[model samples]
Target: MLKILATADIHSPRFLDLFIKSLNKVKIRPDLIILAGDLVDKNNIYALKHVYEILINKYEEIPIISVFGNEEYRGFENKYREMYPVFKWLDDEYIILEMKELKIGIIGTRGALDKPTPWQSRHMPWLYNYYRELPLKISAMIDEARSKGAKYIFLVSHYGVTYKNLEGEPRNIWPYLASSRMEKIIKDKKIDLVIHGHTHNGVRDKINIDGVEVYNVSLPARREVVLIDFTPKSKVFGLEKWLYSGG
Candidate 1:
C-alpha cells in the first residue's frame, strides 16, 4: 500500500521540533510527505533556508509537495520560490505523483478564507479576489487530475473546509476563516479525501461529501501524522492510522 503522511500550518520554528519528533517516532517511511502550507512564519530567505535545511536532512528521499500559504504571498513570495527548489509547489495547478500501485493526484491552494463574510470585507480585502478564484481553480485542477489516469485524488489546503470541524471556534470567526467553498468543489470532483490545517481549534473529523472523506487535520493540538494506505481498485484493500495521537 502507498502511505501518505501530511501536515500543514506549521508556522516555521514550531515545525522544527515537530518535524524532528515525528521523524524519530515514525516507524515506517512514508511514500510521500505533504506539507499543505504555511511552512514558514516569515517570508524571509532566512526562514526558508532553515526550512529547506531541515527538510533536506530529514525528508529528502520522500517526495515532498506543497503550496504557498497566505503568509508566503504577502511580500516575499518570489524570493521564497527562487530560493527553494526541493519542494513541488501546487499553487493554482495540480501535481500527479505516480506511486507503486497508486496514481495519486494532488490539488492544493493555501489560506482560502471564506467570502461573503463581514470580517473579510473589513479586515482582508486584499484576499477577496484570491478567495473568489480558489474554488474555480481547484475545480479545474481536479478535472486535470482525472484526465491524467489518476485513480485517487486528494485536495490539500491550509484552510478549514467545513464548519463541522470548526465546532468549538466562535461562530463569528468561522465565516472569515476557512473555505466554505470546499464542499462543493470536493463533491464535484468526487475526490477521495481532503486534508487541511488552518483552524488550530478545529476538530479532526471526517465529513462525507457525497461519499468523499474530508479530514480537518490541524496538527497543533492533536500533534499527529495521518498515514493513508491506498491500493488500486483491483487490489481491494485500504487502511489509515493516526500516529502520535495514540490511536
Candidate 2:
C-alpha cells in the first residue's frame, strides 16, 4: 500500500507549527506529500522557501506535489514562480508522477468566483473570469492524465469542491469562497479523490460522489497531516492511522 499525506489552506504562520509537528508525528515516511494550496501567508518568497526546505529535509525520499492558492498569486505571478521552484505547480495544468508502477495523476486549479452568479456578484468580483475558465481547464488536465496511463487520479485545489463538506459553514458564503464547478468536474471525471483547503471552518470529512471521495482538509481543522492509503483499482481508501500533534 502506498502512503499519501495531504494538507491544505496552511496560510504560513499556522502551517509552520503544524508542519514541524507533522514531521515528529508521522510514523512511516510518506511516499507522496500533497499540499493542496494556500501554502504561504501572502506572496512571501522567504516563507515559501522555509516551508519548502523543511519538507525537503524531513521527507527527502518522498515526492512533493503542490498547486498555488489565491494567496500565492495575490501579488506578481512571475515573481512567485521565480522564488519557489521545488513545487510542481499545477495551476490550470496536469502533472503526472509515477512511483513503483503506481501512477498518481494530479490536476489542480486555484478556483475563483465570478459575477452573474449570486455568489460572485456580492463578493470576489475579481475572480469572475477565473471561475468561468476553471472547469474547462480541469477537464483538459483529466484527459491529459488519462492519456499518460494514470491508473489513479487525484484532483487538488484550494477551493472546496462540494457543499456537503462545507456544511458547518454558512450557506450564503459558499458561492464566494468555494467553487461548484470543481465538483462538476470531479463527478464527470470520476476522480478517485479530490483534496482541497480554502474553507478554514469546514470539516475534514469525505463525501462520496459516484464512488469518488472529496475531502475538505483545511490545515486549521485538521491541525496535522492526513494519511491516505491507495492501491491501484481500489474503491475505498483507509484513513485514521495517524494523528496531528495537536489534534
Candidate 3:
C-alpha cells in the first residue's frame, strides 16, 4: 500500500517544520505529499518558494502535488510559477502518478466561488465568468483523469466542494468557501476521495454524497498531517474508532 501524507492551508513554513519534526518522531515516511493550497499567509512568490524549498528538503524524492489557493491568486500567478518552474503546480491540471503497484490520477484546481449561498458578497462583473465556468472546467478535468485508467482518482482543490466539510465556518461565509456546482460534479463523477482546504474547519465533518468521501485537510482544520493507505483490502483498525461525528 502506498502511504500518502496530505495537508492543506499551511499558511506558513513553521507548520511544515513542525509537521516534519512530528513525522520524524513517528518514523513515518510517506510515498506522496499533497498540499491543498495556501502554502503561505501572503501571496508573495518569495514566501511561497521559501515554504516550498523547506518541504522539498524534508521530503526528497517523494512526489509533491500542490495548487494555488485564493491567497496565492491574490497576486500574479505567473510570478509564482516563474520562481518554481519544476514543481507540480496543479491548478487546473490533470496528471497521473504511477507507483510500482498503484496508478493514481489526480485532478486539481483552485476552485472559484459561486454566489449561491445567500450571504455571499457581490463579486465584480469582470470576475463573473470565472464563477460561472470554473466548475464545469474542473469537472471535465476529473472526467479526463478517470478516462485515463487510474486505479485511484484523487480530486483536489482549494475551495470546499461540499457544505459537509464546512461545518464550523459561519453561514455568511459559506458562499466564499465552496460551490454547489462543484459538489454536484464531485458526486456525479463518483471520485474516490475529494480533498480541499481554505475553510479551517476540522476533519470532524465529511460529505458523503452518494458514498463519495470528501475531506477537508486544512492544517488549521485537521491539526495533524493526514495519513492514508491505498493498499487493497487494508484497514487501520484501532484508529478509525471514534473519528466519525454523527450516527
Q: Tell me the tens digit of each residue's lDDT in model 3 across 156-225.
A: 8988886666778887778778887888887776677777888886445345677666767777776666
lDDT of each: 0.70, 0.73, 0.70
Scored by lDDT, model 2 comes in at 0.73
Encode model 1's per-residue lDDT on 1-247: one tens digit a residue.
6777777666767666775576566666678877777776765446667667766677668888877775575556556667887777777678887889577788877747776367447876767888877788888878888888877788888777767678767888897668778777777767777777766676554556666666665556346656665544552334354654431
Off by more than 4 A, model 3: 13-26, 116-124, 202-207, 232-247
Better model by TM-score: candidate 1 vs candidate 3 = 1
How do the predictions measure up, each by TM-score?
0.85, 0.86, 0.82
The lDDT, on a scale of 0 to 1, for candidate 3 is: 0.70
| Clash pairs detected, candidate 2 | 114-128
Off by over 4 Å in 1: 116-126, 232-239, 245-247
Best by TM-score: 2
As a whole number from 0 to 100, the lDDT of residue 130 in candidate 2 is 67
C-alpha displacement of 158 in model 2, angstroms? 0.6
lDDT tens string, model 2, 30-90?
Answer: 8888888888886665677768888888888677888778677654556666766666677
